[model samples]
Target: MTSNATSSGKTVASAVRDVFERIYGDPLKQLESLITATGLPVYKDPKTGALLWVDVRELRLRFTLSVNKLEKFIEGLRGGKLMYTQCRRCGAKYFPPQVDCPRCKASDVEWREVSTEGELVTWTVINVKPASFSHQGDYVVGIVKMPDGFNITAWIDADPKTLKPGMKMRLVVDRRPGEGYITYWFKPAF
Candidate 1:
């Protein structure tokens, strides 16, 4: 397999392209199929038995992100380390990583590895997800207070019923499966 290809033997871009093709194959034919399947552009939910209307309008979005200022943070992820930025002048730390120190009005900042240990502040379970995350089961998002006095928000890779505030948490660097991108998340320390 090529370096850019995933274990499934398809590049991430190709997988996304396939999904788009399936969703938008001849709009008129899709509408006809839907109408024939349900006798109209409406259907009854299997679980709730509520009538649902099918939307004919479709929106496709593709965008690019500019990470020029936070290049070091991305590099740290590639290197298997979690990094944060700190203001050299006033000792202010940033988790999302800021290029300039807003507190001290100084551009000089220090890049350092973050401690994996943290405390869970709060969390919530997302039952209804957006289109992109619909494939996955319900997930819990949490805010963790790091030792450096900054909070990082990420998905908690654990059961939500067992979580509580002030519980020990650890930050971990990992690669997400479908999108195949490096990211960080929190998990129960013990």
Candidate 2:
């Protein structure tokens, strides 16, 4: 069995699929074999020595996000810039790029590129992840306070042991692996 810690440079989804194939051969054939022998999807756990019931149902999801309101923000990432939304009416800024200003109940927002400079406010290491992210190694999620006063939540590419509160950070735009989409993240500013 291949160790999960080995690096393959494959997407998380692809890696997970490979693991399943290796364990079960053909999933359909395995299901049929199990049913013929046991009459149920239940099987003995190889490591835990417990009875495990495999779920028969499969679910796949793909989302088409509407970026009409934040189109400029998305475009900025492709152009290697980090963008944010600021309410023209209330002078409030948003890092996640909100179209509506809840403070003034206004729709007048100005999309603007934000400074790369920021301060790390807080962060956490995601040791437990959802199914979609299970193939990847642990990641750090951090909240950065940009110079414009808005906070941006994004993955922090750094050694967690070296990170500290109020540490300097800088926003960066890059393609997200597995998803093949441009996104922003933060890194140690030096």
Candidate 3:
């Protein structure tokens, strides 16, 4: 997670490629023989002169989030509010709210709208990103504990250097780009 301004300026994927280049140097493709014109996925280590395995398997990820008990949360998002549930019996609260009570063994819960104020607990610059998040620019991910002591994970709109733990922040609901869905985020406190 070292940032040198130049390297830090590059995208996550390009940064990873730079790391590979530093370790292995550049790999040149070789056309050693034309055995009836056949293409293969094989390479040899330049320094070791040993054969290396090229993985052919590719991985992709997508999830189907269930909104059964938490359907109200989605509704609140559309209504321009962040909502969560509190166990009526035990007074325990949920951030990514759930319907059932875990501690009190009771399903009695109350859905409440979360306030917009928060204090940053921890954060990181998303210099490296997942495949799906690649299109988004390098962003800040942060954990913030609201006044109720429930933690919410979301992107933070602020400079990395200016970001610090225990700084006041505020929640904002915005329409996510491309997907066009309302999601929550944070900004430096007023």
Candidate 4:
């Protein structure tokens, strides 16, 4: 069996999948063969004495989440406005808006629009990209402090060399290229 570490630019996930395929041949066929040979769908670990049961089948599940509570926030994004939820009783603000206020334990929350301008607090360039966002190359993600006492994190649309702490940034909301989905980012205000 190959070690957990991968080489030759292969990701650890891909390397682990390759090792499993090499040992098992085909997933379903291997499970059936093991059951037929051992009279049980179980196998002992090579490194440990622990016995493991073979799964009968593999299931891939996708969930559809309901956004009923944050519908106004979504609508605000669609309508070119950034919205947040504020607690009516204690005056606590929430971005990625929640209907319930955890701090005050109150359900009395109101939706409000956030300012389009913010000050850049911090940022970093993503060099090691995840598989899903690998195509975006090395991108800058930053946290900006808004005047409303809320900090928002998003991709920063600017040259890394030109970015500095406390720089003014403007919020932009539009459809992401190639994905055709609405997303927000921060660009240098100056």
Candidate 5:
């Protein structure tokens, strides 16, 4: 069987593709026929009585994201440091650093290192993850309110039961487990 790349460094063999088509193709074709007959792409669930709309068009987006404006942020992660952008005109701050100031419409900004400590404001345990991230298993995602008055969303490397609102969390940048890529996370301070 031939293999084809579904994504970067990920391949699906022809046999697997054929099996998937066999499993799902019939229902999809039936749905298409229903849409053609009804002139509407809506269906009602038999068990839940919920109406569902299926789009006639399928969009697959794959593109490269330019990080030219936030090069410092990327470099900071490689150096085990986190950075943010602050507007020189309005004194506003932003995480996931942006070069343009949307508030004042000024492109002038400076990059600054982010505080290492923050307080956990909210969190959630992600039991069902996206296909790309399924390999990592269940994980905790949290929003930490940093000392600088900005919140950063990241994976929390801790037990969910042990976490509480207002608990101190320390930002960490290092190689992610089993991924071999440098990324950031938050962990309980105490």
Candidate 6:
């Protein structure tokens, strides 16, 4: 394959992933079908007769992001207002505020209050979750591209059974107890 790039110049894992994809590109569905049809968790190498056991172990991933650099974002959260960073030089905006603006190749950015109203563009429910979020019921993750063109990632507050793309959404900040951090979410616009 053509030379792939990583932010860190080291991408051995990525290269291995590329090799695996070249060998079995997107085996998720086909593998699932085989597992479903055979009723066994077994997969034998196509080229070699070596057998591989599909471990039933499940893994979930939840990440903690620090808002140390984006203190205005946290303030906005406490004020119940969504905020994003806009580059002072080029006017490039970032939803999940990044310190640097790749567009302008500049780190000089300013925080701006964003509109709460937006339309959901797409979403998915995490049926199988990671350990940290396992305690919580299946949550919906969605993206809403505001008028600023910066899409926000947050849990959408609505019944997963009734959610649809292009629904009206309002951004809101939620105080998660125990963890005690300010995070944002989407609520159905009634």
- Name the candidate that leads on lDDT: 5
Model 6 agreement with the true structure over 1-190: per-residue lDDT tens digits: 1122333443443444455555554565666787899887788888998998765564534478776888877788777677888889898778777779899799998888888788899999999875445545678899986877878888888897777778889877755422334567888999
Score every model by TM-score.
Answer: 0.75, 0.76, 0.71, 0.68, 0.69, 0.61
Query: lDDT of candidate 5?
Result: 0.83
RMSD after CA superposition, every candidate: 5.6, 5.9, 8.2, 9.8, 7.5, 14.0
Candidates' lDDT values, in order?
Answer: 0.81, 0.81, 0.76, 0.80, 0.83, 0.73
Model 1 per-residue lDDT tens digits across residues 1-190: 1224346654446656766566566765857888988778876778999988878676668889899888889899988689999998999898888978878799989999999899999999999875556545788999999988899999898999999999999888866555566788888998
Q: Candidate 4 lDDT (Cα, whole model)?
A: 0.80
**Runs in model 4 lying further than 4 Å from the true structure:** 1-61
Off by over 4 Å in 5: 1-61
Error of 6 at 76 (Å): 2.3
Candidate no. 1 TM-score: 0.75
> To one decimal, what is the Cα RMSD in angstroms of model 2 from the true structure?
5.9
Q: Model 3 — which ten-residue stretch has the worst lDDT? A: 27-36
| Clash counts for all predictions | 0, 0, 0, 0, 0, 1
Q: Judged by TM-score, which candidate is best?
A: 2
Candidate 3 per-residue C-alpha lDDT over 107-139 given as tens digits, one digit per residue, 9 for 90 to 100: 989999998898999999988876456556899
Query: What tens digits encode model 4's per-residue C-alpha lDDT throughout 90-186?
Result: 9999977889989999999989988989999999999987545554568999999999888999999999899889999999887554334566889
